[model samples]
Target: MKSTVEQLSPTRVKLNVEVPFEELSGDFDRAYQALAQQIRVPGFRPGKAPAKIIEARVGRQAILEQVVNDALPAKYSQALAESETNAISQPEIEVGDLVYGEPLTFSAVVDIRPEITLPDFATVSVEVDPIEISEADVEDQLEELRQRFGTLTAVERGVAEGDFVTLDLSATVDGEPVEDAATEGLSHEVGNGELIEGLDEAVTGLKAGETATFTTTLVAGEHADSEAEVTVTVQSVKVRELPEVDDEFAQLASEFDTADELREDLRRQVSDSKKYEQAGAIRDAVLESLLESVEFPLPEKVVEDEVEATQHQLVHALGHDDEQINRFLEAQGKTREEWDAEAKDEAEKSVRTQLLLDAVADEAETEVGQDELTQQIIMQAQRYGMPPQEFIQQLQNANQIGALYADVRRNKALAGVIGEVTVKDTNGDVIDTATFFGGNDDAEAEAEGDDA
Candidate 1:
């Protein structure tokens, strides 16, 4: 077999292959043997029919078709390997100029991954929000602690901002009930925006017999964008009376003997949590900035394939016409082409991140302790409402070795990066996990977005 390659584009190639008479004759004989075994010729025994006799018995076209089906694949593959091409998509094959008992000529076109020049990575820098644990933050955390220990009591008066209400609710779209409508004895806080939009306003002054209806779009699963009318009635109202932040209350709530000790512990926990949040933000910023700094061409077919897969998964998970998906991708600043390109780049980045992290883990000789994995698995199982032993068994049964390995590598990589970065608070003070990542920053994020 002899092959020649032509570069069509960075992502595509054409291969011209010529197989001489010797190999062609052998393939033809094999094809005849296969055909003879499948279909018995009149007087010739099965698997013993001569090639020329089989060709005459079965039409010439049938023999040629059988030979083409059996031999074309191997011939095309040989052409690809010899021409040094790794196709991203199936090839288009065509018979070229040919001669009997001579070289069988054919050509194939295929898509391949384009060569890329990765930009310098080490010099890149990203600006992240500084971790700042303030006195107000500690106070806020202390208040949350007090609330968690608070008791709920039924109230005879009107529903107020901090009051929790048990309500019967039903929502409809256009005039029809939205899938399995009514909710019974649902406990919702009057001021909490956990329910549908305009719900708080409707529940604010309503009594057991009173009902109010308002409009809002659905937010989850299907019917996400459909305008719906939500009817809410307060079946009952209750207010949580938080215990006084005193020494006695602290002793009742926690192991701490005094309110001061409890507050101190809460402050320490909040500070530690904030540190993790800040570190995560820094990591996200760094990766995003790295992506922005790099400019390179990717294989078109790979990008397209990634795009199709992403879209299919998105549609399957979020429903076919999920406008939020479009909005989400749009918010990420992507057009179809841009998103396709980004998807393929994201695949590369993911693989590279894992590879680099694994290498770093090897260099540092890092490991995930059995106890740590056990704790993680236990926490995840509890979070997902599954039995811990069952979840662990499921993980093993499903062969999630790669997932566990990835989790370990990711933690090691982040820890490794943290070691290099000089983490600091907003006032240029040294920051640690004990002071930066635990706040309800998700609320702050939304508020910040609304303000923007």
Candidate 2:
């Protein structure tokens, strides 16, 4: 067999291959023999029919077509290997030059991985808003904990935020009950907007057992496009009763003797969480910088595929219909054309970042130790609200163990990259990495603004 590869673009190519008759002769003979065994001619036992006889019965072209159909994949694959071509998806095939005692010729158009010089990742630096933990942050978190442990007591009072209210609700579309819509004795906090829009406003002033009705279009969610007439009846009113912030409350809530100690501990937890978030943000910034530094022609199909996946994930996140999602996408400044144009770039960036991180991992000899991997799996299981061994069993059952392993390995690689990069705060000041660095940018900003 002889092969030639023609580059149509950075990510695509056309492979031309021809197999000589001598190579195809064996495949054709086997096909003819299979046909001979399947059909017996008069005066001959099964499988004893001559090749000429089979060809005469089935026609030469028919046998050749069958042989080519069976053998083309192997021939193309061999051609790809010999020519060092990597195809991403199935090839578009075309046939040519069909004749006796000659080469079998065909061409395949395929998508290929893009070839480019990787960007200099070592020099990439990113500035992050400082990971700062403050007294107010600790206090705010303590407040949340107090609220969680607080008691909800029945109240003959008006509706207010942070108060849970039990209500019965019903909705209709076009004066008819929506296909599967009704609610009874639903408990919702006044500020939680999980129920249909305007339900809280309509039910707000209602006394116990009092009812009110209103109409509104659902926000962009699973039922965004529809409008419903909702009637909400207040079944009960209740107010949360939080225990006083004191040493006794601290002892009951956690391993602390004083409220001050509990607040300090919660501050540490929030700070650690903030550090994790900041690390992620910094990684993203470095990756974006690295990607921007590189210049290469991207593969169109790869980009299109990535863009499609991104769009699908977005729609899945919205949990909405395609029309509503398109509107949301439009709001994000993404048109069909722009999405298509940007798809390849995004895919290339993702691949490049992974490759760069892997290189760093190699240089640092980073590995997810067995103990760490096991602990990671356990943590993931806890996140899923499942037992560790059961989660591992489920992963193995679903053939996702390899994926889990990959995730652990990739995280180790990213950690190596993070270690090498010097991160600065948004103000160009070096961050005090040793300090108990925890801060919420939004809340901190609000506090700073208040002081101003």
* Residue-wise C-alpha lDDT for candidate 2, range 260-371, written one tens digit per residue: 8988889889988898887677767766665577555555665566667776776787675677667776767898678656765677676555445544555556667789
Candidate 1: lDDT of 206?
Answer: 68
On the 0 to 100 scale, the lDDT of residue 253 in model 1 is 82
Q: How many backbone clashes does candidate 1 have?
A: 14
lDDT of 1 by residue, 1-452 (tens): 89988998877888988887688677787787778798777787789878778777887766665666678899898887777786767788888644455567888888775554433434544455675678898889878878898889887776778788898888887788876657888988777687777888877776666788888877654566678899887888888888899999889988999988988898888878876777787667654554455444455555566556666887777566557668666667777678767777776665445444544455556677778678888888999899999998889998885577657666655554444444444566654532333323434688999999
Question: Ten consecutive residues with minimal summed lDDT in candidate 1?
Answer: 433-442
**Model 2 whole-model lDDT (C-alpha atoms):** 0.76
